[model samples]
Target: MECPNDHILLSSGLKGEEKSYIFRPRFNYSKCTKCSLCRDNCTENAIVMFKEGYPFLMPTLCSGCKTCQLACPSKAIEEDRKEIGLTYVTPVNNNLTLVTGVLKEGEERSYPLVLNTKRRADIMDFDLEIYDTSAGTGNHVAAALEDSEFALVVTEPTPLGIHDMKMIMHLLEKLNIKGYVILNRADLVNDEHIIPDYEIIGSIPLSDDIVQSYVRGKPVVDAFPESDASVELRRIMERVSELLW
Candidate 1:
């Protein structure tokens, strides 16, 4: 019943051997007809035959991939909501809105919240839609970036940055989305050949003004209009506008 990511309770006796899993499956009693398909198809055998002949889930063994729900023709399985994250929408300006999804600390599942946030944004008619994805190419990030027209991958000129940048570039190509790179802190180390395949739309050098703008709780463009960083951002905006409009 214990998977690699599971936290198993290493106690003696049958009752004390239960494990606590991050992803737990909830069975719907009213919708289930004791088809036994869920049990038979589950290679993990997480669903066991109950005394009532209905399906009982050993939550510990469940991988939480929702495969059992797909197997059930009646659609009897429902994933229990764990309140893993919260989405917030705030007005940025008359024309722009900011939607932020905050994942609960120590939570593994964040993609649902990302999807919810995107759905909220999609329902509203807007002139432009920007999906600011999180770092790394996890399912959560994919959920946010999926179907996006363009992904602005911001990275520094370093070995680690180049490595992760290449990974996301490949991911974008796999998703059939055009990607652009904004070399952040370009002054740190300039290597134009690092991500040679992806287009470099704009570059922002390391600057005290850029740091100060962030510290002052404002966008660099709004805080330092004539700063080099702000200029690069404006150039990026113009490019985006040309492509989209």
Candidate 2:
């Protein structure tokens, strides 16, 4: 696969353990045919092909930044962008669009796909955008929330959910982004540990109505606007808009 920025096919490799490995690129110049182009154009000096014909990428020493790709004439350098996944743009309504990045099956790296989707969305003009991120405090979630002005984290009321919520909240705070919590099944958990100052942006009590609407691919706001759950969602959106503006 070609690197999105450089459009070159240099090298590709896996990161992390076997069960959780992700495909990434390793820029190799030994495969390069004396391409001074990669050297001249490399912004990070990541592609260092010496006169003796030894080329190596200092990935840690190097940033994943793509300056060399622009300079390589041989098109020998490439990226693992495809190994990450595909991005799809689906029209939601007149005012909004839903852009999703689904990882190819068996692929372990989901962050690049999210990054690609966000990049595609960034160029388009839109009045409102809502990103439904995957559950986790990993690179994928980080990338999904990167450009968002505000985030609404949804969680169920369970011990595990609360534990993960705290971790996610810490991550948001570290990123210096403001976010609110939406308790998906608010009545299930005790209220003693719930943070008082932290905004309880919305609540959707466990209900057959909400589940039926979700199964029908309908937004709760559209299906049951008068319902308490729908009302809470709107209130949350309003609060989010206020913070964003």
lDDT of 1 by residue, 1-245 (tens): 00110011111112211112234557888998888888888888788996667888875465566677888988888777345555555664477566556666666556666766677778777767877677788877788788888888999889899899988988888888888888899887756566566688888989899778767656778789999999988998999888888
Best by TM-score: 1
Whose lDDT is greatest here? 1
* Runs with alpha carbons beyond 4 Å of true place in candidate 2: 1-83, 194-197
TM per candidate: 0.73, 0.66
Candidate 1 structure, TM-score to reference: 0.73
Q: Where is model 1 more than 4 Å wrong at Cα? A: 1-66, 69-80, 190-195
Candidate 2, 105-210: lDDT as tens digits: 7555566666777777787777666666777888778876776687787877787777788888888887888878888877787765654357777877776667
lDDT of each: 0.71, 0.63
Each prediction's number of clashing residue pairs:
0, 8
Cα RMSDs, all models: 10.9, 10.4
